[model samples]
Target: MSETVSPPDRAHPGLLGQALALRAAWLGMDRAPAAIAFAASVKGIVLLYVAVFLVFCATRPGPGSMLIVALGLAGCAAMPARRTLVIGLTTLLFIMLRPTRSEDLSDFLRRELDLVGSIDQRILIAGAGIAFLAFGMAALRLQSTFRETAPGRHPVLTMMLVFFAILSVALSGLLPVEFAAEVWLFLAALASGFWCIAYALADQKVKQTTDPLPRAAFFRPFWEGPTLPIGKGAGFLAKFEAKDDTALAVTRLKGLKLIVWGALLAGLDAAARSLLHTEAGLPVLTDAMAAAARGTPLPAALSWASLVVHYLLDILHLAAWGHVVVALIRVAGYGIPRNTVRPLAARSLAEFWNRYYFYFKELLVDFFFYPAFLRWFKKYPRLRVAFATFCAACVGNWLFHFMGRIDILAVNGVLPGLRAFESYLFYCVVLAAGLILSQLRKRRPKPEDGFLRYDVLPRLHVGLFFCLLTIFNEPIDAFTIGERFAFLFSLFGA
Candidate 1:
């Protein structure tokens, strides 16, 4: 079995739940040939990076532009395999700056707006022309290996999409919005590029013909599944249906671990902001928070309201962003289980997460403590599995700072520069404590008194959830949490 999870023929149309709807056969090949998956990922990311950068250079911003181009090209030359290396480099390029001041970069970008001026760009255009000629020949010559044997189609639309995409990203930092034409053109390019890539992935699936992986995911018991010994590898990740259904619970259990952790994360962030007001360059909201933070006077009526609103808003934001990336990854062809938000919708908190961010539940299940439990399960059995699972998850939860929480801290001005890292570390400890305490109190399985029925009631859940979220996490709200939540609820006519 390959790592490809195709859309099942019988996929449920209305499930709307990614985990429920998505099923993949267990891949026979747990490991692909020599980093094949990595290579594909890298290639797409690099091609995407290059495509964007080339367009940026075309704008010819300044002498420094030459340096950015040179480094990017050098990276490409060194990592021609077109795998994780390129994509990681590019994605990290954007991500690594969360705590740093981007004002300078933005100003510099404005200076370098004229990609149309760079001599190097002229050289690149010439090179692209030559490459197009060469690709046409290769298309005709080694058509079998290099080109898909599908019916001849120009895919010019995809090309234009890519062009606009590359241009949009390149110009976004380089120009002022006042230049309406350039901005519009750049956006058009990005939209086109994204569409083309989407088409390309779809085309790959169609052309492969034979289904390499399963149409459904498998759940294996702790003893049954092989130890992946890799990152995020423990979850009920759809590795093409490798094991028995009964042994593996339909989904992983760590889903609740992460969502509760995600919620506790808010408290952690609040503590950081409140406690480190000076280092964070602003006041953090609390009951005692200033009435006039961020130029807005706190409203008395919504003091308690905003706190709840903030938390729910955060949930929606996390869910929305998580799904977007998950979709992009699926469309791009990396069959990472849709482990983000869906798991959080469990009827019961546990079931909700299993349905929501299923991966974390699996992560807590397999990756974190499963290994340790694997050693003793024969002797300890139930106790070992249950105990180790949540413990390992606590440790993983504590480390959440590394993956994401830190960025939120910095962006929200919880901590400035390197301080954000330290602040997040502190918050994670508190969050872990919260998660551990919550886990210690779980009663034996009760019938699923699932999610509040509000979701099915004409989107009342969605509206209320987001309204609360918008109030608390408006990013610019600068209001106390209680106030935000209250303000959001008041907006409802009934």
Candidate 2:
């Protein structure tokens, strides 16, 4: 009987059977925790809101003040804020504007700055150029084509080469002046992001830990956000990438939350603009400046409040967009961190700087601060920190902005651009000084420091400083520094 017994037969499944099995496995996550289920539901709602928000905003007509408002929102979202009320109020305005405006959305959108078309073309071309450069560098290093030509071995040289090539393209006359300036600025923006990779490679080479730049990251800056990138380099971002299915799931869930939050913030931005500027009839900075120039100045209190609203809304917009982009990345399995953190709650200038536009700050730190810190200031720790802070907060910051807006200079003439820079220059100097001092005075708060000293005072100081700084930050290109000062002094009855 034992000899006659036959082994049990097994049958193999076909492709369709395997697919069904996969489907069943994927759908069988019923054991996921209650918290995860709740989170997933919330994320779904958020993403839905985000879609509605973007379509509404982008479909609007013309750039005009809307572009400025968009910029303001971008500033807020890209930076950390302590509160959400302003964000909410601003969002409500946009929600209302979208429906009430009778003009055909497509008509307005089609006429958007012709500059936008050129900008897009330039961005793509520049991106392709950078890709070529990156691959060429990678090839040289990988193939040992030239031992001395490796990017890691000659990081500074590699950067310099790219810089000159970009400069040549910008000045090549192959493109129109406006397009050329945009190309230059686009490259500058990308440079701020790419410098981190160069710095990483350089530092690693110094320590014999060099690795090739990830090819996938070469064009990241082009699509990450509109103007400023939230993350710097592939190497840095690689650290945050999800390593497992669980981590990937968590990151995607987080992305959904950000998208929802950003959509809500967009609503707040629209509301703020409606309440403060549209309905209340507060003149925009440009109008206010014009009025002031004509000797019919805005009321001091209103001027101050207007600036605050403008800056707050701008920040909200940036934050909103940043969340959308970052969430998309996270959902794609790259768990890059948020670009901003509680910026409004920052206890110090340095803290605010670090929290706001985090990756931009990182770019400055990687390329400007660290180099100065490590190489030149070893003997004077305080001076070292101050110097490094200046290099980043002032020099790098100013250069980036100036380059980004170089088109303004070219279009309006260099003298006008320089004049416009006066207010910005003053703002940068003050910002640099404050940040430098903050850096030098940085310390861990002791328990004895108390909530008032450690928690309340520092935050208040940061808030006040940023608020005052916003005055200079407003569209002050048309006005002299003297005019801006007079306007500020008028506000305080000085």
Candidate no. 2 TM-score: 0.66
Which ten contiguous residues of candidate 1 have the minimum total lDDT?
215-224
Candidate of highest lDDT: 2
lDDT of every predicted structure (CA atoms): 0.35, 0.57
On a 0 to 100 scale, what is the lDDT of residue 129 in model 2? Answer: 42
Q: Tens digit of lDDT per residue, candidate 1, span 260-337?
A: 333444445555445545464332234323443333444544443445444444555455434333322222223445
* TM, every model: 0.33, 0.66
Residues 154-232, model 2: lDDT tens digits: 5655665766577556655688855564454344434433443354454445444333433223323222343344554
Which 10-residue window of candidate 2 scores lowest in summed lDDT? 98-107
TM-score of 1: 0.33
